[model samples]
Target: MSSLTHTTTPANTPVERKATRSAGRRTSPNALLSKGVVNALLIVAAFYTLMPVSWLLFAATKSDRDLFSTSGFALGDFNLFANLHHVFTFNDGIYLRWFGNSILYSVVGSAASTFLCIATGYAFDTYDFKGKEKLFAAVLGGVLVPTTVIQLPMYLLATKVGIVNTYWALLLPALVNPFGVYLARVFSEGYVPNEVLEAARVDGAGELRIFAGISLPMLAPGFMTIFLFSFTASWNNFFGALVMLNDEKLYPVNLGLFMWNSVTQQQPEYYSLVITGSLVAVVPLIVAFVCLQRFWRSGLTAGAVK
Candidate 1:
């Protein structure tokens, strides 16, 4: 028995050496350390992003006096209701009008923009037309050019067309998103298979009917993505509103809030109203993302499989 044990012990040495080498790797724990570092960075990033938003939240709850007196994060006299009352009742409830205007602009403009983008992209993907590539190149070039750069040109054109200072002024400009067209074309290529379109064509389906029945449904994710962008742009269209509109009744929420904020220097009481209005303005954007994000996420694999 003792001789056998001694012989077995010599054979176990290689296995033990292998185990020891693995144990040495355990000492570094590189993967765990990497996860810890990554987690730390994410926490820091989250905190940094949330800090101002946190301040906005707590500040919104406070009265005008508490806003000045208390630390930004500290809870103060809960004047949220009063602030809301002031916001809605001020200037014959003009804030509500502004809010409604924003909703109309965002909803109408985004929907129209999304539809136009999907159609244009679908056509670009499916059809061969005269100078199509050159036309698309021009559209791509439009993406490179900043919207601000064309503001003057657009303003002059709108003036010539007699659409300035109108809803058309805001909505028309939003309809021509080069980036949305680009995204739609990509989505069309991936989501709407050429084979499916060919099959529809073989069935004697018209182009419009095929798009409405099949391709549009497949392009749901692209539509939502473009809509979100267009909606946000229309909602926050402060500079455009500033340039085009002189009528307070036609003002969108951002421009309305800006008008309120501009007066805060003289009328300090308007400060709370401005903050509360700003908070309210953010709600639609949040709601939009929360509602549509699932569609966007699920689309990544929606057509990837069968």
Candidate 2:
């Protein structure tokens, strides 16, 4: 009787094992195919995005004569140093002045913008004031307004104020970043808890003290993100510089590069300088993004969890 029972059990176990194996087999092909397609698309997209950057890097190393003649992907004569030398030494090192202007505009403008955004955002998120919703909606509307559409009017206003050719034109306009305000508002809502603010108040801390001591540290990641965005925007601003700055001394790198490109049409040698200048100009932004990427990611994910 025990042998007969064991035989029946073996038969039941085989049937169960076969059923489980068949279920797994049914799902495996579809799962494998989906994963394969996703990976393939990602690889293709990555190549497409990287191709232009790769060309720029290799193009920067080539001499003017070889730039058009050489294959886009192939390495030409390693003339990167020579090109940089030309870029720096041309017109009494004017490119260096442009670089300096860009740095000043980006750093100072972005810092001011970040501070203002933080203060305003904290107020909007933490306080309930008269017409607060209306004011915020107005700000959101301002964010949707195309910057280029306003550039002409901004330039006209600057011209009327007689600050068009000065650094004020660039710096002043950049300090009022609507997007930075929007981002800061979103970040502050997530980072600065109402309960924490109330607790700080209960502890007899003043509003300013509470913000500085408790909220600012929590908003550091958001501040970094705003700084990066404002800096990049200010650094890469072309139209503002083009319309406002007629003085080459006040021109940022983007405008300076544009001027060089304009000359390239008449003088082919300027092409190399333009390419090299572009490569150099982009390096700082790349370094900035790489260094602050962790902070940026943290800021984006800050309110997502809790």
- Tens-digit per-residue lDDT, 1-306, candidate 2: 455443344655887999988889778988889989999999999999888778889998898889999898888899989889999999999999999999999999889989999999889888899999999889989988988899999999998999989999999999887788888888998888899999999999999999899999999999999999999889988988988999999999999999889877789998888888888998889899999999999998866876
CA lDDT for candidate 2: 0.90
Residue 126, candidate 2: C-alpha displacement in angstroms: 0.2
Q: Pick the candidate with the highest lDDT.
A: 2
- TM-score of each candidate? 0.87, 0.89
- Backbone-clash count (model 2): 0
- The lDDT per prediction is 0.87, 0.90
User: In model 2, what lDDT does residue 135 have?
Assistant: 92
Positional deviation of residue 147's Cα in model 1 after best superposition, in angstroms: 1.1
